[model samples]
Target: MGASRLLVSGIACLIDFDDAALSGPPASAVPTVRSGVDLLIEDGRIVEVGAGLPAGTAEVIDASDRVVLPGFVDTHRHLWLTALRALTTETDLGGYLESVAGRLGPRFTPDDLRASAYFGALECLDAGVTTVQDYAHAMRSPDHADAAVSALEASGIRAVFGYGFPVFSTARDLVDIRRVRERYFPADDGSLLTMALSPMGPSYSPIESVREDWKLARELALPIAVHVGAGPVAQRPIATLEREGLLTAGTVYVHANSLPDEELRLIASSGGSVAIAPAVEAQMGHGAPMIGRLRAAGIGYGLGVDVVTATAGDMFTLMRAALVTGYLGAGSRPSPADVLRAATLGGAEVLGLAGRIGSLRAGKRADLVLLRADAPNLLPLHHDPVGTVVSSAHPGNVDTVIVDGRVVKRDGALVAGSLPAAREALLAAAHRIAG
Candidate 1:
């Protein structure tokens, strides 16, 4: 008798979006080959990757003509906007505050928070996203933070539940950052769910208030993510933070879209990472030289699905929109894999969690996406798989999603049942806000 074999389903295309050890971007930025390959996932990590394995000892997922990629990591998203989608798309930043984050944010009861957060998470999961840097910036009340945390917990998604200062205008309206740190941060076990200080930053927050929040994070050694260049664009916060010697690696400067080359070089030199929300930037009149300058500084850079009010929360849209906008605007174009990695590994680096998540390596956590290329729209794989993903694909192509060895989505459906009610909760909130 032959040795017992494990299931080895073959994929027509496999793109490993890691390992670019070269002077510039490698030709195969994401390694690929159009050959029969089967990924044996054991205890969650991919155990083997080759062809012709014996069978019968493991379950099989026949992905003969499908594509596989790492699950997306959304570095910047206002998950609270799940309840207020497109509510203020027509409005400017002030209008956004008054309409959604101000009015709708205040109206969210804890129940409403859970409903929207959990629902938004499910939306991401069903679309094959396994990780999130959720900017949960709409804590109407302190208890709403609990609702936000609970929503991430229940969804089985690996996320940094950004513990934002209570949604407010003046820094005085902000809650005690100290209390938020001590009470709501999920700092146990260094596990999937953790917290980052997401103070509204110097624009919405006073320098004094922003400094206070930074103090709490520094005291706790917690990473902090701050929104920049999305609003008044008055001062380059990166330069300001650098001058104060606060632009350390743990400081993630998001949407530095309007900042120029000089400012970007300063951020890169200061060891701070940047997350460009290109779609939201263009949609909001944030400005040109958005992602291009950030990349040129030899600084760490990533992508994000920022501010769902003016954009969709899914990463696919972010990738496609950014890549096209970037290539069309640049002298040279980044390969699709460079684009993909920006959304995953690049994003993981932005959040300062690169080693634990992001890739499909042996020691990394099992965070991945399975696209059913066997589907009609996915058939006829002509171009590169990574290109197909960022170009031709949508959320519907996602057949399964895994996060930290757990299957969160399968067969184009969310594993959690509460998602429906949660979706309804958002619909109801929109109506109430409208009235």
Candidate 2:
């Protein structure tokens, strides 16, 4: 499908956003859920959303029994780890570091990075995640980093390619941001593909190296994402960052399981965001999940499928896990709307792209997911749309997916060709790396 005029008609439910909704927190405006509406798009942007819109020459998509929503934005994911699926199932984070990152990561070639990134991104798109932050941390060389970027571009998923620098790398391993940015992300305005600097966090890197990396990212005006609150050594990371004047709204702290209350408050005050990968955090023993604490602090947070090696890399699993954990910890159930928002709009805000692709609003990019509400597991419609989405719908219920006004998945199948071949290539890469 071309990026021309398109109309999605007869949507059973539409989770649309208004200016007021984006003006405050996720729950502030209470997302406007409308029934039986049509959305019009042109040039890869939503132009009109309401009832009774004319469908002229535009390609018409029938969504009578489907739910239309902003495509999910996954705030954090190590895409290059998909080849090592379930490799860390029984291991803790420390074990993972020793076994995977220490042993196998350095052995990977540029071809391996390319294969894993391409496969990981397609998995997300097929599962209804249209945008993701590919935290490509295995950049053994500049060629390896370029391979990761090339794979993401080929996959057609909207992404922020996070260039993860290796710890204690020589000066030759450092990224030439100006040169690479010009080659891949030249516009410097807003494009589907953006860039971020993912550095070794304060807990791992020497403070001097951390300062240098932070300064480089800030000078480039790019967002920074780092792992935080994994254990005692990382307690109150925001304070250290604040002392160095490195904390800002562009920073996205991942995991952040059990920081001090004052530190959590400091993050919110400093306009920083958090990305919680609840399933992986709970399974990998990264303290308790921080969804409740983040909410209590009024800090913006979004869901992340941290690693495919340990968890199901999909939004449904992430959302359900977050809700269950939040309830178990806080002794109160979080609103379904809030959870959905975390997976979609909240994730966008954390990535600093909320104004562009978070919700079904006019002038926003046409990244959307259509789920079959009439599917067997999702049958017996409920009164609440958000509740239905959170509790009942699974990735299998995804009927169609659109990114940038292009119909990438139609009738539950990917429009892109040769996915089986890609899977075979991934299997080969995984086998070689494992050996």
Q: How many clashes (backbone N, Cα, C below 3 Å) per candidate?
A: 0, 0
lDDT of the structure predicted as candidate 1 = 0.70
> Lowest-lDDT window of 10 residues in candidate 2?
166-175
| Model 1: residues with Cα > 4 Å off, grouped in runs | 1-8, 19-30, 53-56, 166-168, 171-190, 230-234, 328-331
Candidate 2 ranges with C-alpha deviation above 4 Å: 17-19, 23-29, 167-172, 230-234, 330-332
> Which candidate leads the pack in lDDT?
2
What lDDT does the true structure give each of the candidates? 0.70, 0.83
| Residue 330, model 1, lDDT | 38
- Would you estimate the TM-scores of all the predictions? 0.89, 0.95
Candidate 1's TM-score reads 0.89
Candidate 1 per-residue lDDT over residues 1-435, each given as its tens digit = 111232337776766656343222233345554557776666655556778754457767676766767778888877766777776577765677677766667777787778777878888888776778888776656677778888888777788878775556443324444566566563656477877878777545556666766776788778888877634533767666666556676577877766667777777676777778878777666666355555566666678777767888788888888887776553346667777878777777777777766666656666778887777766566665667777778888888777766667767777654666676777886666555
For candidate 1, the per-residue lDDT at 122 reads 83
The candidate 1 region of ten consecutive residues with least summed lDDT is: 19-28
